[model samples]
Target: MCGIVGYLGKHDTKAILLDGLKELEYRGYDSAGIAVLQAEEFSYFKAVGKLANLEAKTADFTTSGFAAGIGHTRWATHGKPTEINAHPHLGDASYVVHNGIIENYQELKNALISEGAHFLSQTDTEVIVHLFESLLNGGLKPFDAFRETVSRLKGAYAILLVTKQMPETIFFAKHGSPMIVGVNESDEKFFGSSDAALIGKCHRVIYLEDGQLGFVSRTGIHLEDAHAAAVVPHFASLPESKLSAQKEGFRFFMEKEIYEQSEVLSDTLIGRLAEDAILFDELNPSLLEGINEIKLCACGTSYHAALASSYLFERLGKIRTSVEIASELRYKEPLLCTDTLFVVISQSGETADTLETLKMAKAAGLKTLVVCNVDNSSMVREADAAILTRAGIEKGVASTKAFATQMAVLWMFSLYVAQTKDTIDAETLRKQIGLLREVPAVVRVHDDLHERIRRLSKRYLHGHGFFFIGRDIFFPLALEGALKLKEISYLHAEGYPSGEMKHGPIALADPELFTIALMPKNLLYDKTKSNVEELSARDATICAISDVPFEKADDFIPIAAHDHYMLEFFETMVVLQLLSMEIAIRLGNDVDMPRNLAKSVTVE
Candidate 1:
């Protein structure tokens, strides 16, 4: 994934672009660069690692008088993470900053090489600039050349182009990747991959749809479709308040987001409970009327949330439910039964594979609903109905509040579906609602919890990986815990249903292998204890996270015992999140922007 931002205004172009890039730093990047039109010529700088390096490289080029500019924070896709392979890819008289892959770049590159076009970088993005340059040299007008270059390209992209031929305008194109453009109070046009990148800088934003190509000049935004037809622009009010890349008082975004879970969960539940019914006013009940089965699709943390929801859908809704990894489900040619409700979950709502899966389901005439955190994302627009997670901005690449909010939303959806299907009685509905309402208070854990976990983390740095095992819904929580550890700490970890350990996983259990067991007393308590004992018999060191204290554990992290299963889920989740975060912190890892991991999965 890469971050793209641009400016077409009379302000300090370099300063504004750099600020926007910082807003997007949470999106993992390997290299960064910026190109600005200064003194009738393009002045550009590129750096290999981090935005700070790029800033340092361009420190002396402080020209507040630039015409237009574009910057990119690139996560290497078609090239190594090298300075020369970074963005602001140059042509003869233009520069480009791009996100997403160009599938036919190699073929186009071979053709261009045969035509004697010189190439500088080993990135698919470089082909685009060269081709545009070639088209311009062939007597095409600047705008015509831009369109021709895009017409020759294949695969997903959200591109921003700055050319000397049109020094006042920043041309852009969107296919399958996400891009947004907006203007501030000064009539300055701005561009960003996500609205978060332009939140504080812009007054209103226009989300560009696929195949829409246009430019933003001092006049205004000029957008058009592939057939050269003018399309009416849709603008979203720029949201107000704290989406800045501020960790508040915490050391990192992950820690801050973890601490924000209580409020995040409460916000997600607001207006969700009205009288006795679990009301989702946005969704038409007709979609669920004939739904015989539920299919939950997502990737990574969202996948774990979906898997956890699968258990709840079955247990509470009395419905047949299945979880599909979005990436795999796309290639598998999954059966799209019309009677099934297709639910897609994504934090960014722009996860490439998940978006494609949702598209496929729609093509097959299936009713689709998206559970997403970001409003106005691709999936939200594509799906028939959407439920916003209300998690605010999750800048942490490892994801903290996003997962919790997604779980909260899915849990509510399950209850709504249960009531609609007549599978839940009045008493059960009230009890579930009461438990749902109590989530904000239950997740408030032990005061000494973080300090104690910090001390416990020191003992786990050299373990032979970890086995985060649980049962039922906790099995997915186990998966989430392991994912958090491996994504941030670079340690090896695997999650399994505790009972499935002896089938094969238990063989590798040794004194060095650690097991973070989720043995909630409210659900399958005795069975979880039995599984922990089995691992202990094999000398596996145990860090049991439980509401009820367990004497057999090598280390016990006590959580407040709750009568409801979801409350226990929230309590155990806080422990696992803290434990993984503290371990990564002790290992001196960059917990916010984990290595090789991006905040949003914008590319396949």
Candidate 2:
């Protein structure tokens, strides 16, 4: 993933572009670049590191009298993180910055080379700008040339181009990646990879849909489809203060997001729960009645959430359920059941693999439901029905609030389906719904363990590797915990079912190894405890996160037991998140912007 920002207005173009790039640095930080047009000439500056390096190199450019500019923060998909591979790549007559991968870049590059075009950078974005220059040289109008170039392109991209030929205007397009147009009170036009980049600079924003091309000038912004059909733009207001708030006393965004899980979970379940029932008016029970099975698809953290949902859907809804990783599902010849309902889950809603899978599911004649946080994401627009998680802007690369909110939504939906099928009586449903409301209160107690978790992190941070063990629904939580640790802390961690430990993972256990055992005292507690004993016998350090203390564990985190599955799940998740955050902090790593990672995976 990468971040793109541009401006077409009277303000200092350099200041606006640089500030926008810094705001979006969380999306990516490997490399940064900016291109500005002053007196109809392009001035470029780039650096290979954090945004601070770019800032250090562009001190004079910020004061230059530029009319329009574009900037980028790259995560390095096509090439190594070097200044040459940084964005704002040059063509014969223009500069372009891009987000998302260009799948057919090699073929396009060969075609351009045959046409006598020279490339300066090892990036797919360079091929695109050169193509634009070739079309302009072929005697096409600027708008028509952009349209044709996009038509020939394949794979995901959100591109922003500013040509010397059209010195006062900025042209842009999106296929699978996200792009937004923002207009301030002064009618200044701003472009960004996400709305977060436009905050404080512009409030009124328009989300650019896939397969759309547009241009912004001092006069106004105009949009059209790939076929040149005119498209009307719809704008929504985003409050700057709410989105751009300062981290109040928190060391990092990950820590704040981990603590925000409770409030976000409450917000996610707000209107959907009642005294004795859960309501999802968007989900037609009649459709669920007709479908014999359910198939859930997602990627990364969302995939773990989907795995957790499959257990809930089968046990509570009394339906056969299967889970698939979106990336793998797209390439395989999956058995498409006409009677199976497909549910796609994503936090950004623009996950490329998941979106492609959603399209495939729709084409196969299966009814689809999407669970997403962003309201108008491509997945939400294409699905038959959608459930919004309402988890606000998650800036941390490792998701915390978003994942918990997704679990809350999944649990609510599962119970709703079960109630509709009469599998769960009214009284049982009421008790579950009541326990859901108390999750926020129970989660608050996790802060008491912060000091203890920090101590455990100090003890285990130097271990060779870590293993996370749980069973049933907890197995998915185990995977999520390991993912969080590996993403931020850069630790070598693996998650496995407790029963499977003896099969293969047990061999990796030694005194240098660290293991986090989730023995939640649930139905499978005894089975999981047996695995923990095996690890203890091997002298591997064990940190048991449970409702009750275990004498054999090297460290113990005690959470009060709950009969309801959701409450116990939420409590354990909070503690595990704290552990990861503390470990990453202790290791002196960038907790918010992890290495070779981005907040959203727009590229496959």
Candidate 3:
């Protein structure tokens, strides 16, 4: 994955594009660059290894006065993250910044080579620039050149292009990757891979749909279909508050997001409860009748959310449930029937594997529902029905708030299904919904855990081994916590059911290892505590996360004590998120953007 930003305005083009790239650093990159048109020529600067390297190289340049530009921070997909491979990829007449893969680039490149085209970098993006140059040299207009070039291409792409011939305007198109155009009051325009990159700069934004192209200028933005039919843009305010983008004295976005969980969770639950304590109002009545089984398809952290959902669906809805990683679901070829309901979960809604999995289920004529953060991502668009998780912009590559909101939404959805199926008694459903409603307030009590987590970070900073163990619902929480640590912290963390420790994982336990015991105050509390005791006896330093106090633990992180289900299902997860951030920071890692990872996996 890569980050792309473009600007067309009165401000210094270089300054605006560079600032936008900085905002997108959390998308993860090893190289960055910008292309600005000045003095009737393209001026470019690029460097390998972080945006700061490019910034340092361009420190002496006057960024002001340029009218239009495009910038990119790249996560290498087809080539090494080298300075030459970074965008704005320059051609004879046009410069381009791209976000997705060009799957047939090799074939295109071979054809171009036969036509005597010279290549510089080993990137699929370079093929696009050369193709544009070829088309433009053949007398096609800039827009026409882009149109023809895209017509020949296959695979996901969100491209921003600027030409020396059309100095006042920028052209953009989206096929699969996410791109949005933001318009300010003065008619100046901004476009980026995510809305967060353009947040305060523009109050109004138009999300470009797949296969849509637009010409943006200081006067306004004009959108068109692939066939050049004029179209109106649908605008919306940026989902996140302006302040949420600011650190607000916090060192990182991860830390700030961790602290914002209570408010985020509360907002997610707003209007979710009905007079009878049913969770959601948007279920298909027919699907709720005689549901035979439930299948959840998700990837990465969302898979963990699904695992948590499986626990709740079985317990609260009294239904058979299975959680399958989206990438593995097709190969496994698990039985699917008309009576089976499939739930697809994704933070971006554009995750390539998850979307493909959802399509497969929909093709099978199964009832499909999507739980997603983005309003109209591919998965959401393809699903029969969907629930939006209003988690706002999660720019950080290592997810914090999104995971919490996913869990919250899943819990509510489970409760709703339970009510519709008449599996849960009315009073019991009411009590569960009541507890769900109180989660935000309970999360508020432990909001100060960040500092405590930071203090313990050094212990796990160089730790190569980590074990996460929990019982019942906490098992998924444990798995998710370990996944977070491994994702960003680069720790070798494994999550196991507490009861399964003696099965094998305990053999890895030693003084050099760290064990995070998710000992929630639940029915399995004693079993989890015994697992912690077993780790402690093996000379492992135990970090006990629970509402119940433990005597032999090295560290006790207390959560607000609540009913067994709520405690196991909700509060403990928050602490694991904090710990993931703290450990990442201690390792001198960029917790927001882990290396070699992208915020959204748009390419398969």
Candidate 4:
């Protein structure tokens, strides 16, 4: 994943571009660069590693006046994170900054090389700028060259191009990636991959549809449809906030987001739930009418959420359900029936594989829904309906609140379906609703709980490997817990259905094997306890979470007893998040931005 920002504004162009790139830092990158068309001449600076390095390298660079500019923060995909592989690659007549992969770059590059074009960096993006120049050299006009260059690209990209000849203009295109264009009261223009970079900088913003392309000049913004027809764009008013990303006195963004889970859940649940009724103003009941079965697809944390929701849909709605990883789903010969409801979950809603799967489902005539956090994402615009998680700006590369809110929304959705199907009696429905009402309270971490986790985290910092084991719905909870630990702590971890541990994985269980058991007293507690006893018999160090005391637990964090599993799920999620964060902190790892992980995976 990468970030792209472009501007033609009255304010210092350097400041605006750098500000936008900083706002997109949460997306993750290893190298950064910016190119400016100032005083009718192009100048650029490139640096590997953080934006700070780029800032330091360009400290004495001039920015008093500028015609146009583009910037990029790159997460290396095609080459090493060297200055030579950074963005803002220049061609004979163009300067370009790009995000997303260019699949057929080698073929394009070979053709360019054969034409006496000089090559430098080992990046796929450099092929784009070369192709633009190549097209221009063959007698194409500026816009023609732009469109022609884009037509040949075989993969995803949101490209911003500035021609030395047309220094007064900024040309752009998007396909299978995100791009937002905006303008100020002064007629100054801005472009970003997300609203976070464009907020407060522009009065209004237009989220470009895939294949939307055009230019911005002194007169105004222009538009071109995917089919090359001129059209007018619909713009939305920008919200009033600087959209700052601070720790809020917490050690890291992950810690702040972990503690904010209570309020995050509150925002997601507001006006959407009652004692015995579920309300989704954005959804029409008619859309749920012909759903004969359910199939859920997602990747990473969202996949875990979908896996958990499948259990709910099957148990409560009496519907047969299946869960698949979105990447695999796209390649397989999937049985996407018209009567089957297809659902996808993503935090950014721009996850490349999930979005591709959505497209496949749409083409197959399957009714689709997206459970996502961003209201202005591609999936929201493309899916039949969406349940916005409203968790608000999770800056951590490893998700916390996003996962929690997703589970919350899916739980209510499952209940709503059960009610419509008459699968549950009044008492069971009321109990489910009441359990949801208790979620916000249970996820709030008390001082006692945090301290207990912090003290016990030291014991876990040196484990050879970890087993997060549970059964039933807790199986997915175990997956999430293990994923969190592996993501932040950089430790080898696996989640298994407690019984499955005895199959082959239990052979690895030893004194150095740390087992975090989800022994919630609400669902199948006795069976889970039996599983933990087996692990204990093998001399694996055990950490049990439940109200009841565990005879074999080396450490214990007592969760409040509940009849419904969701309540315990909420409580156990908090403990798992805290445990992972504390262990990462003890190891001196960066909890907010984990190594080799981007917050939003916008590229495949």
**TM-score against truth, every candidate:** 0.98, 0.97, 0.92, 0.98
Which of 1 and 3 is ahead in TM-score? Answer: 1
Q: What lDDT tens digits, residue by residue, belong to model 2 across residues 114-145? A: 99998878888888898988999999998778
Count the clashes in each prediction: 0, 0, 0, 0
CA lDDT of each prediction against the hidden true structure: 0.89, 0.87, 0.82, 0.89
Candidate with top TM-score is 1
Candidate 3 — which pairs collide?
A: none
Give the per-residue lDDT digits (tens) of candidate 3, residues 408-522: 8988888888877778888888788777878787666353676677687777776558888888777888889898998888889988899998888788878788889888776
Locate the minimum summed-lDDT window of 10 residues in model 3.
442-451
Q: Model 3 reaches what TM-score against the true structure?
A: 0.92
Looking at candidate 1, the ten consecutive residues that score lowest on lDDT are: 238-247
